[model samples]
Target: MSFNITDEEVKKLEDVASQVRRDILRMVHGCGSGHPGGALGCTDLLVALYFKEMTHNPEFSMDGKDEDLFFLSNGHISAVLYSTLARAGYFPVPELATHRKINSRLQGHPATEEGLPGIRMASGSLGQGLSVAAGAAQTKKLNGDDKFVYVLMGDGEQQEGQIWEAAMYAPHNKVDNLIGFVDYNNAQIDGSTDEVLNLLDLGAKYKAFGWHVITCEKGNDMKTVLETIQEAKAASKQGTPVMVLLKTEMGHPIDFMVGTHKWHGQAPNDEQLASALGQVKETLGDY
Candidate 1:
């Protein structure tokens, strides 16, 4: 797909993102538990991908041939992924109300056993998604598909030793068809990522690992996100893998939830939900 998007298209995508943020707040509030901070922070990038960037078929398939594929590495924020998938026509939008419910397809983390339309694998463990994405990308290469594989990982997940192993393997094997992201929100459940485990100069680390690195300081902004992703896609398949260091605010537009790690896995109460819903306009109507 072409990366050049019109201003009108950006406005439409912004509308979809607003509705998605509203969906995240409602789903977490309905369940009384979830990771809202990162979900809300990552809304723009997900919206841009499903709505405007990715060449995916919401018709849903496990093989994922002839299309760009995305995997959520930090699956704690399943709220954003579910909402984005539903809004993108992968499933009924009303299914979002069942998030984290008993036996619901929209579980706390993405699961393959549920046979959910968009989910290809179960993903909640911290450091495994990059490996899965690398394997999928390699398969595409071996099959001569020429499509791209994408994955999103949390900055806190960088603390895991397995992440470095995948980092080394992908570049050394010339997995140039893969594009990965690290959500550099800097906050985790215990505290700031720096306090828990300082991932000093993540971009430099990736560069040293023989990967092309792109930095997007304003990950929450729709326009900047589109441009950065376009740049990343253009950089793909050039004999080196690409990584985007996405800098984002934890709670994003909501005031009370922003600026701290406390909201990492905390759900909004009735009043907080109302306040958050009030902040994000319900452009496409609630699910």
Candidate 2:
């Protein structure tokens, strides 16, 4: 099934993406440390989900009744996620400026201690979110709620033994309501995923684990991202979980940062941030 996204909506998504990029920079710069590469790479996907696809009301609590649930397995990218959520009305966008600062609800990694409206679980330890998402999916099933549980994980995170354990369990338990996404950007904090821990033939691996694997070669492309997610949603009907390997360029659209592992947890200095922000227009007024 083909899904059509209007030009106006595309413009809106681009606007949101720009604001998210700004927020990421400001958030990281404010704290003096954080992950910006994965955050930037995943910006468009978060914008697409919150602005278009997901059935969510940011004003509502995290109980998620009549709404979709999102879990960020790559929790280090909290800047992008928090910005997207705020822009989507999950909370005041101004709060993003306090990200990673001491006593702020937006921690270096997301935590439920603050009881933030959009965040459901504490993450950042890695390899645990899939299990958390699986548990949420099961809860939704038990409650007779037909909402979807979405999760995003990094490609390097695939090396975690727990991810494979979750992969093996989800399908066997018939967790069809869950959809997992891998930000297959190749680069990790240390180096390329291939260099650190190769995840060759990831699609085949997901298939082997009983998931219907889909690939999105352009994770930064708004239209392709939306279409691929729509297709995955359409294809989830046979009691098997779905996984999409999204190939993204870390720090995409920035000449200096793209395709490098150095940007994974580094913050751009004043000049670099200015240069990066100049490349992405502020379509939506910066908060």
Candidate 3:
């Protein structure tokens, strides 16, 4: 089932996001690693996609046949994707405990060697997933599959020359089936993106690259997040690929981590985990 979202159903998606956030915190806290800031910030966006937007089977497949595919370019946020995949029924939620451990399919970032059900690429080195997604879009086109290819990247990843090349390639090649998302939280591992390296006017930049661009002003809001994806998909139908600039708080819902760059790769301690968990409701129980 893809989606037929309504106002009343927004709460359902919010519950999914909340539990996913808790999973993210616990997964990172359990392993004492993983990037929670971007994971938490991008929770609503992923939840909106997996739970309410993308049409795909829970059964794993290396070649996603006739289905919508997702690629996580900023692989450091593996916590969110693992949580989303588990919650979406790709695997048992308890499997989240295996993350970051030796021999675990759920690596610190999404890993293909482990044959992770939902991950098509091992994408830790930033600024590469967009091109991968673009290639997948082209494959689907050649295979006569109209399904969409979705990819998410960090705002800081925009600095990479490879990303710009793919950004230019997608629209120029008329790969309209691909939808790209940028987690515009402004926080990167080292510091705020502006402090590190300014990425100005992403909407204008993507538009200039010939992409149909959309802005999600409040990506943390489930309704707005889901609605924005719908808008992006609609925009992608007219022979131009779409790129969405999703504005988010680096560490959303967690009071101490919110709006800061410090939590990018830092896991919360025992007391901190307790407090963070309090802010995010635990639904569907924790893995």
TM-score against native, each model = 0.98, 0.98, 0.97
Residue-level lDDT of model 1, residues 64-150, one tens digit each, is 999999999999999999999999999999999999999799989999888889999889999999999999999999898998999
Cα displacement (Å) at residue 285, model 3:
0.8
TM-score of 3: 0.97
Who is ahead in lDDT, 2 or 3?
3
Sorted by lDDT (best first), the order is 1, 3, 2
- RMSD (CA, Å), candidate 2 to true, equals 1.0
lDDT of 2 by residue, 1-287 (tens): 76878888887788889888888887887778999999999999999998998888888676797678899998999999999988888788888878888788898899889877799899999899899999999998899889888999999999999999999999999999999999999998789989998999999999998999999999999888999889888877579999999999999877788968999999999899889888888866787
- Model 2 scores a TM of 0.98
The best candidate by lDDT is: 1
Count of clashing residue pairs in every prediction: 0, 0, 0
Sorted on TM-score, best first, the list reads 1, 2, 3
Model 3: ten consecutive residues of lowest lDDT: 1-10
Q: Write the per-residue lDDT of candidate 3 for residues 1-287, one digit (tens) a residue.
A: 25457877798889999999999999999989879999999999999888879998989888999989999999999999999999999988899998899888898878888787888889998899999999999999999999999999999999999999998899989999999999999988788898899997889999999999999899999888887998888888689999999999988989999968999999999999999999988778887
